[model samples]
Target: MLVETVTLQIPEILYQRLVNTARATQRPLEEVILHALQTGSPPEWDDVPEEFQADLAALDKLDENTLWQIANSGKTSAEMERYNTLLEGNSSGTLTEAERLELMALRHEADLFMLKKTQAAVLLRWRGHRVPTP
Candidate 1:
């Protein structure tokens, strides 16, 4: 690609956002702004599964605090205990119909929770937050 220099003035809010991203990523402000311009979103949602695209896409509108809270959340201890028991029963082929249904519901809910958490982390990182791995 050929290099071209262009000068432009951006609003204060946009400039602050770019500066924040640059700081969080430990990169230059110009590089962060350039990446944002080229990729649209720092984190791409287009490649996510069709069923999850809408859910993930909506995270873009969330505030940083809310996204951070979500990124740090997890299933409750009680829920995890129950889910584990159900999973063990499933592996043993000893689950009753009601138990099986409950297990499936729990499994689906867990999947959704994990996906949401991952999306939230991605958004936080894109918005210049240091999202640590779980």
Candidate 2:
């Protein structure tokens, strides 16, 4: 296949580093640049610098909550609106210190209530009784 050549004027520091990398890896500078461009993100394949490998490896171990929305993915539009409202109310600075403390207490109590309900539902299911919640 015929390949087209395109010229890019990169900063001298970056160009020097790319050339040094090519020499170290025993790959053509043009090939290294092309591979890096194709990857769009560095550390995709053979052209990544050794200095970045450790940081890249660390990124590979991100948890689902950090990388993907798992629990909140199933929320409907109405549920999302309600959640957002609660968050807004809780975060608003207009609340006095006493009101803020009360809000925090209410949030904590709601969380514990939900936890108990979930446990009860699970137990009911195990005992062959239908438990319903939305």
Candidate 3:
């Protein structure tokens, strides 16, 4: 792939830390910085406010909601087709309530995956990883 070079300004301490990390991992400085850039958190905030911070339990809830939104994007017709396919595959009797709920959840997750893909593409462009088309 054709790549473009860009310069970044970071604090001396952070630069030294990156160098140390690269040495420890036996990787180049560029590689270490690139890895950090890819894994870094979204740039919505420099630091989150204490009041807005959600604990692990809240994070679980947020994840569950995100999954539900993704999975339920299919319309009624699509859902029926999915249900029929499942029934066809499982010739070993009726589905339990919990099993049925799980299938619905999976469908919802399928919907969210599309949104996540778009999000990743946008982020990549913002981070200069991918060239954005005009």
Candidate 4:
């Protein structure tokens, strides 16, 4: 693919965070930035799974306040406990077939939720919202 170089004056704090991310991930800074630019927002509906289409559509309708709420939400305590239990079972080679499937489904849901939250954060940043750092 053809690529063009462009100059950007990134804020020092954001630049530091990007640099840190690149170092932690063992990726090139340019690659990290490019990936963020490409995937930080909601993807096209056609590119998403059929099961996620409705969720994505709902995300599309979220106001800034609602988006903020979604972006800040974390897994419930019950979800965390279940995840830990599954992890323990897997590590011990004792997970039942049903438990294995449950763990996989839970992981999938967590991944989807994270994707949505990230997209919401990107939207918030685009709208000039002051999102707090972790």
lDDT of each: 0.77, 0.48, 0.50, 0.72
Clashes of each: 0, 0, 7, 0
Q: Rank the candidates by TM-score, best first.
A: 1, 4, 2, 3
Instruction: Estimate TM-scores for all models.
Output: 0.68, 0.33, 0.30, 0.58
lDDT of residue 128 for candidate 3:
38
After superposition, which runs of candidate 3 have C-alpha atoms over 4 Å from their true positions? 41-134
Number of clashes found in candidate 4:
0
Q: What does candidate 1's lDDT look like per residue over 13-65, in tens digits?
A: 55765665566556788887887887563565667668777776666556677
Instruction: Give residue 61's error in model 3 in angstroms.
Output: 37
Order by lDDT, highest first: 1, 4, 3, 2
Runs in model 1 with CA error above 4 Å? Answer: 1-35, 38-40
Writing each residue's lDDT as its tens digit, candidate 3 over 1-134 gives 99789988998755765665455446688886787688762222113434333221122222323423433443478767776676654556577777667666765554444444344343343333543333
Q: Which stretches of candidate 4 lie over 4 Å from their true place?
A: 1-54
Quick one: best TM-score, which candidate? 1
| lDDT score at residue 56, model 1, on the 0-100 scale | 67
User: Is candidate 2 or 4 superior in TM-score?
Assistant: 4
Q: Note the residue pairs that clash in candidate 1.
A: none
lDDT of candidate 1 vs native? 0.77
